[model samples]
Target: MRADPTRASSADASETDPSGDDRAHDAAVPIARSLEAILMVADEPQSLVSLATAVGAPTAAVRQAIESLVADFDGADGGTRRGFELREVGGGWRFYVREEFDPVVRDFVLTQNPTKLSQAALETLAVIAYKQPITRSSIAQIRAVNVDSVVRTLLGRGLVTESSTDSETGAITYETTELLLTHLGINSLDELPLISPLLSDGRGGFDDVA
Candidate 1:
């Protein structure tokens, strides 16, 4: 037998709300956590459009949620220390360690035994630091040897970084890192201790320091 029209009307009436505000609220916590994880794993800064699509939300809403997360991390709720933080740089959002804890983190990471550097690597770094924005071929010309391995090792260690690529020749250029400044205990490149006096011997030849 078919159900009665009257019964169907009763069921509809029971389900209806006059105010029409009974839609269940969606929790933002899970979405926020996913956003955090994405930023944390990214090797570099992430963009708003990319993150919004990743979290399945509108860009504006994602931006607000990211700001909220930043506030939460900066707050002192007294739990486990946060492993990473959300930061804005170069007009993009990035995850980085909190500045206050960087020293501790560096100390922990640097405790490992030293790795050896070849004479070529040492010379290549010196040339780049003193005459930066230099190309790999220039370095090779100066050292009179192939600088490929030296350049590769420097890039891997973060002691050197690419400055730009020459448009005409498509040559990649390298420069010293800020880490080099800190390592050398100097305020800036201009403060690098002078070796010019030693190089300026009367006939442009100096005694070897052996």
Candidate 2:
């Protein structure tokens, strides 16, 4: 018996069509893994468009991935809810420690790791303590080097915090925390050494050093 030509043509079409098995397989691969990996190290929340561009996925696909992650973290898939959650904030997405676990995380961070600050961190902290509500650029100018990592370390240690952002320049201004005072055993910044006595220029303490 001869094979039917129409059936043979149908089989050929199925094999040749770009929308056949290959596309289905690609669709089955979840984009959540890509999104998760990017979110893990992101210091700030990323917008959907930004996330899509980073992962080289379509915006709709990224959105769907975010939804899937949210569901999984919420235990909607019959699994234990995660201690942390992906959250959308300020028009972007980031992971946050779930409110119920905040105390545990905070305590662990405070008690478990009491490592000493580096010399760079001490100098950055001193600058922030004296010149507070100062921009990172100004701090860098005073230090005559990049202070990014040291400033981040101070922030991580809870010794410095963002006081405010400049309205015109959009620069973040940092200030020392009460925790710094507690560590220094001082009541106020006035307890710090006088700048004039330390400077050869007598008018510019930090600038002279810089």
Candidate 3:
């Protein structure tokens, strides 16, 4: 027997794949599609490392997938440009509504949602009112609850507005809008009543509204 083919083939296969990483990568969902699914529901911009780990792909592959998504959303590959785009801001990727659609979206939200805010919304709003330029994460930490939907409700009602996303972290800060002042019939935030007296522990961290 001249050098058994079975042993030779086994040796070659072992040499080619010393680790099972390739199989795992191949088994994962397509990188681009998986990334899209995650970014769609992501509240904050996702960094390359985080996204790569999340999708079980190599960083190089994830970067390539991100580029492909950016082009696809921008219609650079001969398709209609989407109403939203994948943007890299604060050193991470996130989706943003096209600026031109703002007015239409705003009008629709205002008209469609007329019922008064639920108690949760009111509490969330109070936190933002006093902690101007606060991030959603901070709000949730303070209230000890998730406030994602409540923040969206405030944004839709035009009672809360966002500041520029943090340049390094991609964190979006929120503050009460003029509409909030109008709703309260207050000329300025300073005019709001002090809530320190109402605190059980008499904490000073709370401002005139929080």
Residue 15 displacement in candidate 3 (angstroms): 27
Task: Output the better candidate (2/3) by TM-score.
Answer: 3
Worst 10 residues of 3 by lDDT: 20-29
| Residue 41, model 2, lDDT | 83
Better structure of 1 and 2 per TM-score: 2
lDDT of 3 at 202: 59
Which has the higher lDDT value, candidate number 2 or candidate number 3? 3
lDDT value, residue 15 of candidate 2: 81
TM-score of 3: 0.78
Candidate maximizing lDDT: 3
lDDT of each: 0.70, 0.79, 0.85
**Cα error of candidate 1 at position 200, Å:** 30
Please provide, for model 3 over 1-210, each residue's C-alpha lDDT reduced to its tens digit, 9 standing for 90 to 100. Answer: 599999999999999874676664454438889999999999877999999999888898898788878888899958889999999867789998888988888899989998999999998998888887888888898888999999989998889987767654678889999999999999999998776777786564564454
Checking candidate 1 for backbone clashes, the offending pairs are none
C-alpha lDDT (0 to 100) for residue 20 of candidate 2: 50
Query: What would the TM-scores of all predictions be?
Result: 0.48, 0.61, 0.78
